[model samples]
Target chain A: MNERQKSKLVVETCLLAGKIMIENGSEMVRVTDTIDRISHNAGATEARAYVTLTGIIMSATPDMGSQVTAIDKRTFDLEKVSTVNDYSRQFAAKKISLGEFYRCLKRMDKDVKPFPFWLQMIGAFMVSATLEIVFRSNYTDFWAAGFVGMIGWCIYCLTDHYTDIRFLNEFIAAICIGFMSILLIRAGIAKSADDLIIGGLMPLVPGVPITNAVRDTLSGNLVSGPSRGIEAIMSACALGFGVAMAIKILG
Target chain B: MVNVIIFSVCVYFATIGFGLLINLPRKALNMAGIVSLIGWLVFHTVNVHMGGYLSADILGTFTVGILSIFASRYKKMPVIIFNIPALVPLVPGGQAYQVMKCLAIGNYALAKSNLIQVIFIAGGIASGFLFAEFLNQLYLRFKTYIITKKATR
Candidate 1:
């Protein structure tokens, strides 16, 4: 393919990949790679496919995440561009993958100081701790912990959307979970307080992420998988320290 | 005073479990407080009317777990979310608070006792949870194996 054709393919692929990400909660890289593979399957050369993929990624732009869920389905299905490409364009316009968009965010890095992960952790902790405080019963502490967990998850989701890096978000989540557990223990800490503390930390547990990241890396996804594993490990360490400190200092 | 505290605490935890199970909104989740008291009443009646030192807690905790699991399934929510809610009533936070308070006041003996109690409680919670989860996994695996074997035969 010539330069012009390669550029067109890239733009088309990026838009299409973005659409798929929104509908399927898929990784942007994997989605794009699949499209690149398909193009190759369709007889495109490797070098041209690479350029096309790069172009598609560049064209995805910022603001795709917040916009993805907002656009109606009809806008994506134009008959002239073929249904798939039309849908892809719609995804591009709607901003399907926030994280991927942020991958391109450094191009215009000024004026966007994403909310610090620590503050979000504190806020999530507050919501969770309060619930445990009010409900001195069996379910009270657990509910509070879950609430806190969700808060951390939400913050991470937003951060992951913007930066495409999971490290800070996971750390923040771990801290929140740790704080929630300590709060639960300090508040009603009777014979069964373990249930509360342990339960509260469930959401922020790094087990799954750590396991998956390692598994992926071992299976040959160094770029994507190991990054996730490292993030999980960091988060787990943060959580352990946070709990120890809270218990020691507050006591 | 302890009775009042018990009633209120039970209600709150129950509310958390019920709200989670039902997939209610944020505002509705708080209602776990109001309804769980009724559950507490069941325990209270069994102990108070019957004059038993039954601790009502064991049954109550188990009830929360069973109900919370059911609630999550019904609500179409993740079990992880509901797991915390079910554990709300069993946190032993009060004991922990008392232990810390004793230590703060330099009552070392009482603090020591409370600390041991805290360990016991946490340990009990973990053991019970492990038992339940293990049993469930075993049962599921056995059932699946039986079904598969029968199908092959």
Candidate 2:
């Protein structure tokens, strides 16, 4: 309510946002969530404020994910970040219009740079595998099986490169790739179904789930975190099955 | 063993360099890499016994999952970038190539079995984590929902 309390809330919120933004690949969504939580402390409107913030980010840089890690993002000191978060939450709670939020996002993007790691890696890897299959001397169903993986690889790279690249991306890509691989292989394109399925899953390869699995266990989030662990396993199995059935069908 | 350490160090440096590029303090970046490397090693060591593509998938996923957590905790580095070196080795390149070869020659059963085997290998890695996560949560919730609820009430 008071300026002093608002100030403290702002500082903490900003610092938290900076940390999460720095660590995770997705910024816009995380920042929004941070603002929503911090707005409660600042006598600000969380919903209206977040919409404003989202608009600002979208306008500033169409690719908010890439911009999150840019050097410019470092300029968001605790106070400034805290104030912005509070302001949005307050505005949102009041059902206020967020013309300003949209403007800020637009401005913010000039300072944006999308993270390219996932993109380059996925693309490079996909290209590599696709090339290997496409170039196979004999034309066979094997390449067909691997084709879905190539697409999953592309989606994985696209999503991960500029977005949060979460656990879901890995699973979805793997499953899609797996599903497609079987279909392609069964058609007797001569490509081994399993090989193509596994190859297609390259993009979804585990990066954080393993770490989180242990860390969650370490920190004691067994229920919430481990469920994610199981989901990862099941999805991976689904991916395998998706392809296997196709193979069986052709047989 | 020696190669592992050397590679780990290189990954650490490259990861740090990326952190620096994004303006993270040296201490934070170094810490992220250290945590990630430990995870990578755990995966590599545990899954090394599996032959060929299977080994690569297990190690790669394990290495990456751990590295991302470190990055997430540090709050200053991009978790994805930190996972680069950890993932490179397990891209499924060689296995994909060979399987394609076997199939092209009309080895349906071999291709089918290999497909099942690699999928199982990758799935197995996820399953290991599932065990760790599930037991950990069950214990935590059991304490909270049962013991803690009684005490609090």
Candidate 3:
């Protein structure tokens, strides 16, 4: 490839890498740092990266000219985030050439399987059950939380797969959790419906978002920080709305 | 006490499940669990003695931040892998849930209080991390300065 072609490829590669990291919920500092490192090492004259929760804007200047790319896709899959992170580290260390980095990124985009749905469901179940212990609930509530959590996660997986409505999956999942926990209480299987519902809700909480928002704000990325804070609150509202609807109906 | 043990063990598995939910890297899973267990234990112990949830959050998050730095170096993984999951149980989910539940039920006063509590706890957690990071930076800079000075001598 000529210098122009090589620079264009590097710019595109940096943008692609940044998109993957941001979409996978990486923090702004890490995203910008990785993009900068990759582009500079790949022989760009200069590179700059700006990231937000919803999109990414990155530019690179090469001998021929300057190139800018913006991607507007947002999703959360931390496994992919970790993979890109490790890959960037390797590339920065000069262990991977430009062609190799491109191939690695393509392979990452195509490969890297998510955990099977059933395992995620089992994880949901264990989280809910163990949350009862964390909340200091009795064995009855413990068993109730386990069942409620498992069923709730299944509902979440199903809704998330079948629907594209924003926040609808969390809404429906919370409704299922609340409804099942109440039913367990009515059936005398759980002593405290509130405890059971809370435990079941553990898996659906927006803990990661909240933490990331705080970290972002602390790091001086003011715009991204508050936006992420609002995102976390919105998620909480969706879960709460679902639970509330279930309560209003079940009562 | 036995209760403390129960809390630690239960939170350990709960955190592991949480790590799995977010699909943390396989190598970081067990370490994340240990980090969670330690964070929650410190939070619990401090909250019990200090009678202040905010203080507990600060101490717990500070410990998690420090440990995450070391873990990142030792395990050669991103610190977020350990930090985010370890900080999960301390995110004040219950308060956030209460804020929504109260609002839905038309309990305005209760909802307002829960909102304030959530803000306070979140702020405390952020400050904890900031303080830890600041200290870490200071220590690194000082070490570098001393190393160069000694070499010159």
Candidate 4:
């Protein structure tokens, strides 16, 4: 490719890298770092990336126009983040040519595969049951929490698949967890409704976002920090509201 | 004690479960679980002996943060992959749930206290992670300085 075309390709590659990292729930600082590293490794004289929770704006050299990519959806996929890190490290070390690196990134992005549904359900079950014992120090509600948590996570995934509304899936999942926990208590299968509900809600809480918000803020990304913090708070509020609604309606 | 062992086992498995939920790479899952187990053990011991949740949380997350940093370096992965999963057990999900329950029952007083507690715990976790990062940065700088000094000699 010509020099101009090469610069443009570099910008596009950086933008694609940033988009994947941000969309896969990488911290804002790491996103910018990865973008800058990719552009720099591609021989850009002056490359800069400004990343926030919602978008990424990157420019490489004055001749090549800057590129902007908006990030609309985010989900936890640390595996993708690690893969991008590995690819960038390889590119920086000259182990992979820029063309090959770009091609690998494109293929990886297109062929994203998360854990299967059944395995994820089992994870949810184990998280709820084991956390119940850890927090409440009781095994009476172990199976109850597991079943409720599995069903709640199932509802969450289903709602996410069917609905496009933000935070609605978490709300619906929390409501299901509440109702299930209460039902189990009524059926004399669970000893404590509080323990069961808390355990089941473990899978739904916004732990990653909250931690990322703190880490971003601490690392001096003022823009993305509070934005991610607000996202965490809003989801927490959605969960709390759903649980409250369930209790008000049934209790 | 038997209780400590049980809690430790639960935390290890629970951390792995959370790791799977977030799609952590398979090779790092066991290490993340061990990090979480150590952190929770520290938190449990501190809380039981001292009767302070905030301090226990701060110390627990500090240990988790430091260990995850090392684990990431050893595994050649991003620190976040290990940090997020290991931090799950220390997150105050139960207290947050109780805060909502209090509000639902019209118990404003209890809700207010629980809200403050949640904020404090969140802050503690944040500071703990920050301190760990700070120390890591310090260590890196020190290592670089020693290398340069050796070169000059």
> What DockQ does each candidate score versus the true complex, computed on alpha carbons?
0.04, 0.08, 0.67, 0.84
Predicted candidate 1 versus true structure: per-residue lDDT over A207-248, tens digit per residue: 334323433443455664665556555765564454444455
Cα lDDT tens digits for candidate 4, A80-170: 8889899999999999988888898899856667888899999999899999899998877889898898899999999999999999999
In the range B1-153, model 3's lDDT, one tens digit per residue, is 887887788888888887778888788889988888888888999999878999999999999988888888888877788888888778776787677677767899999999999889988889889988898899999999999999999
Candidate with the larger TM-score of 2 and 3: 3
Ranking by lDDT: 4, 3, 2, 1
* Candidate 4 per-residue lDDT over residues B40-150, each given as its tens digit: 999999989988999999999999999999999999998898889888899888888889999998999999999999999999999899899999999999999999999
The DockQ leader among the candidates is 4
lDDT of 3 by residue, A120-212 (tens): 877887888887777754665777788888888888878878877767888999998888888877888778877777888898877767777
- Off-target runs (Cα >4 Å) in candidate 3 are A62-73, B150-153
Candidate 2 docking category? incorrect
**Cα-based lDDT for every prediction:** 0.44, 0.44, 0.80, 0.89
Candidate 2 lDDT over A1-251, as tens digits, reads 55544444444444444343423322233454565554443444422322221122211212222112222222211223323443455555754334344344335435344335444343434433432332232224334433554477566545545765334455455555655655665555545654455445543444334333433444444453464356445544444443444444444
Lowest summed lDDT across 10 adjacent residues in model 1 chain A is found at: A71-80
Assess every candidate by TM-score: 0.36, 0.40, 0.94, 0.98
Worst-scoring 10-residue span by lDDT in model 3 chain A? A62-71
Angstrom error of the Cα, residue A20, model 4: value is 0.4
Q: How close is candidate 4 to the true structure, as a TM-score?
A: 0.98
Model 4 preserves the real interface contacts to a fraction of 0.75
Error of 4 at A200 (Å): 0.3
Put down candidate 1 lDDT per residue, B56-82, tens digits, no spaces. 444444444345445544543322233
Looking at candidate 4 chain B, the ten consecutive residues that score lowest on lDDT are: B17-26
- The candidate that wins on lDDT is 4
Give stretches of model 1 more than 4 Å off: A1-251, B1-10, B13-62
